[model samples]
Target: MKIVIAGGSGFIGGKLVDLLVKNGHEVIILTRSKKTPSKNVSYILWLQEGAVPENELHKVDAFINLAGVSINDGRWTPKHQQQIYNSRMTATDELVRIISAMEVKPSVLINASAIGIYPASYNTVFTEKSAEIASDFLAQTVKDWELKANHVTQFGVRTVFTRFGVVLGREGGALPLMALPYKLFVGGKVGGGKQWVSWVHVEDVVRAIYFALQNDQLQGPVNVTAPTPVTMEEFGKMIGSVLKRPHWLPVPSFAMKLALGRKSKLVLEGQHVLPKVLMANEFIFNFPELKLALEDLL
Candidate 1:
């Protein structure tokens, strides 16, 4: 299969590309910069002036859109928030246009989504079937992003919105920062520590995308979190245990709000998301337990 991935240079995208290539699939990465092509991988310039990426492609089997500004990059100023929203909308719009122009559209489009679409609740467990949507900034961004990506279904392409949870990995995502406090022996509960943290290993995230590509029955929003969801307190202790550090010193919620502003919601609040679709589809998780996942990544 020849797969085209927008924002293929990103954290999760980089790992996904490696997995696809390792599995003997031809991978085309759409990026803003040029990269030297490898044996089973090629990088095509997109989102740049005078670059006709669609013209440089043929019979693309799958299209994965992971393009977006990182919400964790900086404080959520109005300008930064706009950039976050615009980046996803623009990339997805371009993907729709490119797919429309294609003579043979891909079989499936796996758009990167977030579990933030679900409202943050301690007791409420959310799955793909959950219809209650949050009105927060991140949730709204995800909702609109998914709506934009949904346009590809009109082109007869199966669309899957992989709503990712807190992707825990060594290189990127939320692990390093979260583990830093523990490493310094000052990590304990953040905020109330009761807020749920639905985390999945980065490897599981990549594998889930691969599974979505192969499974025809998968469509619409699919939660890409682990089977077990832990509270923030449990998460911190697990990290300490894995790293052999001490989980002490609690950070108050007000301090976090003052420091991170609206971005504080990323840690101070969370949803207990479950991978219902993946489980029903018989997808096996490489690192299902948080302790095991932390040990592997640490």
Candidate 2:
């Protein structure tokens, strides 16, 4: 399979590309910058405004649309929120435009969504079947972002949306930042420590991407989290233990609220999500337990 990853140079996408290449698939990565190529990887400069470079479209078997802005990159100021919205919508729109114009479009499109589409509350266990999205910044952003990709289904391509959990990994996702305070022994619980943290190991996330692509029956939103969901407090302790550190320090709710403003849900709260679709489809997790996952990554 020849796969084109819209944002494949980053952490999760890069890892997935490595595996795809190892499995004898040709991969092309779309980047915003001009750079030299690496072994078995080709980088194409993608200007989201115009049509995709026609030379890169030949014989493209699948398109993995994982391109998006980080929702937690900075303070979610009204201005920054607009950047988040525009960056995602623009990239997604361009991906759709390019793929739609292909004489032989990719067989499948795996779009990335988040569990953030669910309310960041412990009051519910969110499944792929859940409806009525939460009315929050993340919810609104993901809802619009996903709708843009789902439109590609009209081109007769199978579209699969992976509503991700807190992706626990070693590289530049959220784990590296989480390790900072913990390394100093200030690693403590955020908010009440009761909020559910649905998480998946980075390897599992990469593996799940291929699993979804290979299985033609997969469509719609699929939760990419572990089978067991842990609370914030439990997560903190497990991580601390894995790193051989103390987990006594606690960051208060007031501090978190002040730090993040309306975007405090990134840490202050999270939903209990279940990977119903992935499991029902017979997907096996490499690191299903938090301790095991953290130990491997740490």
Candidate 3:
């Protein structure tokens, strides 16, 4: 299959591209960069305002829309908030509009969504069929994002709304950044550490994407997390053990709030999400346990 990834250069998208290519599938990466030369993989330049190149839309067998502004990039200023919304809404609107106009559209449209679509902290288990969107910064952003991507279904296309957890094992993802505190021997739970940390290996994430792509029956919001979801304390211990560092020092919630401001929920709080859709489909995960996943990375 010829796959076109909108944000193929980023963390999860890049990993997916590598796996797709090695699996003997052709890939075309669309970015903000100038046109370059490559084999099997082609590069096309895309921007928020301009139109997608005509041939580029009709050339691929699948379209994976991962283009968006990093929600975790900066402080939650009003301007930054607009950047977060515009980056996702604009890109998704364009992708949906383009695909709707295609003469022979791709069979699948996998738009990247986040587990933030659920309430940040919940005792009740959340599943694909559940609707528990937290009325906060991240939830509102992801909710609107998914709603926009759902528009493609009107055109008779299979739409997969992937709700991702914290992805680990990739070079620059949570592993490297989270390992820093452990390597310094001051790693410990954030806040009280009781918050659940739902996570998955980068490889498993891409695999789930393909599973959704192939399984036309899987539609709507699907949780793309490892079957095992651990608390922040256990997660910190996994990192500490991998780095062989003492994790006794604890960071208080006030410290986190001071540092992260409103975005502290990304770290201090989490959701215990189960990949109900993937598990029901019997999709196998390469790294379901956190220890081996950290070992593979750290």
Candidate 4:
């Protein structure tokens, strides 16, 4: 299989590219910058305004879209919010446009989404089947993002929305930052510590994408989180224990809100998202428990 990946240079996307290449699949990365091509992996610059290169847009086996700005990168100002929206919607809408134009459409289109689409609640467990979309900025952003990606299905393509949680890993994504405070011995719970932190190891994140691509029955939104969800306090404790540090400090919600504004809710509030679709499809997880996930990543 030859796969085209947007945002293939990022943390999780890099891992996914390595996995696909190792599995003997040719990978083409759709990047925003110019880059030299490797043996099996090639690059194509995306302008998002004009048609993608005609030759590269033909007969692709799978198109994995992961283009988006990090919501946690800065405070969610109106400008930053628009950046996030354009980053996701523009990239997705462009892919849909290109793929729709191709005479031979890709078999699968696995697009990225987030569990933040679900309303934040300490008790409610959200699955892909959940109908309650949060009206918050993050949720509305994801809602529109998914709406754009789902449009590809109308063109006879199988589209899968991999709604992610906090992706934990050794090198990148949120784990290193989350573990840094623990390593420095100042790690503790954020907010009230009751907010659920649904997370998955990066290894599973890569594998889950492969699983979704191979399984034809798997369509629609699939939660790419571990089945076992932990609270923010529990997550902190797990990180502390894994790093051999004491979890004593507590980050107040007011302070985070003051510092990060609406972005603070990413740490202060969360939902217990379960991988109902993934598990039902018989997809096995490498790290389902938070402790094991922290141990491997830390």
Candidate 5:
């Protein structure tokens, strides 16, 4: 399959591209800058002034949109928040236009989504079937993002919104910063630690995307989380155990709010999300347990 990926340079996108290439698929990465082409991979310039990426792209089998501003980049000021929302909307809007112009539209479009769409709750478990939508900034962003991507389905493209949880890996995502406190031996539960942490290994994230690509029956929203979800306190303890460090020195919720402002919600609050769609389809997780995942990454 020939797959075209937007935001292919991102943390998850990079890994996904690697997996697609390794599986003998031709990959085209849409980027703002020019890059030297490699075997089974090429780059196409997009999201720029006077650039028509659709003209250069042809016979694209699959389209994956992972383009967006990172919510973890810094404090969510009004300007930064607008950037986060605009980035995703602009990227998806462009993809829709490009697909509309295509003589042969791609079979599937797997847009990157987030579990943040679900309201943060300690006891409430969310799956793809959950209809309760959170009104928070991140949740609203995801909701609107998915709505934009849904336009692709009108072109007869099978759209899949992979609502990702906290993706854990060595290079990027939330692992390094979360583990840093433990490495310095001051790590403990953040806030009450009762908030759920629905996490999945980066490898599993990549594999799940691949699985969705192959499974024609899969469409719409798919929770790309692990079967087992842990609370923040349990998560910290597992990290400490994996690193052989002491899980002491609790950080108060006020301290986190003071430090991260609105972004503190990323850690101080979470949802108990499960990948029910993946499980029902018999998708296997490479690192299902938090300890095993932490050991592998940390």
Candidate 6:
């Protein structure tokens, strides 16, 4: 299939592009760079409110939108927060509008979302069917992001909102930053270490996206996390064990809050999310367990 991917140069998206290319699928990346395209993969420059290449989007097999600002880039100042919200909303809205104008619309529109849509709780395990929406900045941002992507359904296209968790890989996302302290012998649990972290291997994340594209019944919000959800304490232990480091020292809640401000929730708080939709559909995860996932990446 010929797939058009927005933000395909990103960490997870880059891996997905390689996987897609290896699997004999053509990839057209919607990037902001002027980098030359490689074999079976191409690029199209895109910006907010700019002209879209309708010719490239015409009759595409699928449109996978992963464009968004990183929530962990810096402290969540008012301006930073607006950038986070605007980046996702603008990209998704533009995609939906472009796809709507297509003569032969893509069969599927897979939009990247986050599990932040659910309120942070140690006990509650959230699934795709969960109707509860958290009343917070991250939750509302994700809710609005998904709502914008859902607009494609009006044009008879199947829509997918893959709510990602902490995507762990060797190079990018949360693992490297989290592992730095462990390597320096200062690594430990954040806050009280009771917050539940819903995580997944980068490979499994890519697989889930492909699975959603193939499965006709998979629509709406689908959690793209590992089946096993671990607490911050357990997760720290897993990292330490894998890296052969000690996991004892802890970062206090006040220190975290002072450092991250509102973004402290990214580490000090979390949601126990399960890929119930993927499990029901029999989507096998390459690294379902945290220990092995850490070993593979670390």
Over the stretch 50-128, how does candidate 5's per-residue lDDT look in tens digits?
A: 8899899989999999999998788888899999999999999999999999888999999999999999998899999
| C-alpha-based local distance difference test score of model 4 | 0.88
Model 1 residue-pair collision total: 0
Clashing pairs for model 1 are none
Residues 1-298 of candidate 1 have per-residue lDDT tens digits of 9999998888999999999999999999998988899999999988899988889889899999999998878899899999999999999999999999988899999999999999989889898999999999999999999999999999999999999999998989999989998888889989999999999999999999999999999999999999999999999989988888888899999999998988999999999999999999999999999988998999
RMSD of 5: 0.7
Q: Give the TM-score ranking, best first.
A: 5, 1, 6, 4, 2, 3
The model with the greater TM-score, 3 or 4, is 4
Per-candidate TM equals: 0.98, 0.95, 0.95, 0.96, 0.99, 0.97
Residue-wise C-alpha lDDT for candidate 2, range 81-142, written one tens digit per residue? 88888888988898898887788888899988899999877778889998858898889889
Cα lDDT listed for each candidate: 0.94, 0.86, 0.83, 0.88, 0.94, 0.90
Model 3: weakest 10-residue lDDT segment is 48-57
RMSD of each: 0.9, 1.6, 1.6, 1.4, 0.7, 1.2
Writing each residue's lDDT as its tens digit, candidate 3 over 103-122 gives 88888889999998788674
Candidate 5: how many backbone clashes?
0
RMSD of 3: 1.6
* lDDT, model 2, position 9: 70
Superposition TM-score, candidate 3 onto the true structure:
0.95
Give the better candidate number (1 or 2) by lDDT: 1
Over 85-162, each residue of candidate 6 has an lDDT whose tens digit, in order, gives 999998887788778778999999999999999998888888988899999999999999998999889999999999
Candidate 5 Cα misplacement greater than 4 A, ranges: none
Clashing pairs in 5: none
Best by TM-score: 5
**In candidate 6, residue 93 scores what lDDT?**
79
